[model samples]
Target: MSTSRMPLALRALRTLLWILAVFGAVGLALGLVGLAVMTEEEVVRETGVGRSASMAALLPGFALVLVEAYLAATLIRGGRARRWCVRVLAVLTLLSGLLGLLFLDVAGLFEVAVAVLLLALHESRSAREWYRSGTETGKPDGAVPAPTG
Candidate 1:
């Protein structure tokens, strides 16, 4: 995109994304371990389902980890795809936070805060301009220069 230096806010967002990704990774690992160690009866008791159904419960956590990792990499590389990914992540985070609140999980409130911050940054004029700067037009700033004689 614009070969120019990345904005400070974007840099900060990237760092935050990396941190979130790491957290997701750890959560995923722990979830997998818990699943592995759970006895069939324990799984049924906890989920009110069979072993297969209990294992399916971890899929969402795995997906979250994958999405976080992809977002971090895209942000790091300054990929054109990052804009869309950030938007998706922000919405997903907000939804997750809402769900958490509904379930009375305190941690969901924190995710909601993070989602708000991300949405604010992404919607800012600077971030919009940055995302717009790099596009299929192949011109920096997407401006058509005046033709010279």
Candidate 2:
């Protein structure tokens, strides 16, 4: 928790989390819509067969979206728990992306794009150094140890 790094790191984490949350919201919305189509007789009657099937297939994407949002929020808090959430979200994102592509869902492509951008932000040079050195390991480069006094 270096004083200087705290502000910047928190800001970066917040931005990344918010971005993931937005994507998750979209997925959740889509999932709810799909569920409606799957269960409602009126929806089927109105939209017909193909659209209903398409909606049904989108359920998993929506579910994954909620999970991603939770993980992103956890990431901001920064703990062992948060780290685990990140891993889960990463895997779910990959799985959903694959499913979306296979089913020709455009939302899957959108998820892929956002996930890539967030990953780039998280893996930026500064972020990595902060993660590796700031937490529990080496001191910042060029930092001199204090005199024994």
- Show where candidate 2 strays beyond 4 Å: 6-13, 26-39, 44-77, 134-149
Q: Provide the global lDDT of candidate 1 against the true structure.
A: 0.75
lDDT tens digits by residue: candidate 2, 1-149? 44224235435655666666686577667766666556566556656655557576666656655665665454433445555565556556666677898999987887576556555655567655555443431234345656676
lDDT of 1 by residue, 47-138 (tens): 79877876687788778768877776566345557788898989999999999999999999999999998888777777666666663333
lDDT of 1 at 44: 80
State the weakest 10-residue window (summed lDDT) of model 1: 135-144
Q: In model 2, which residue pairs have backbone atoms overlapping below 3 Å?
A: none
TM-score, structure 1 vs. true = 0.78
Best by lDDT: 1
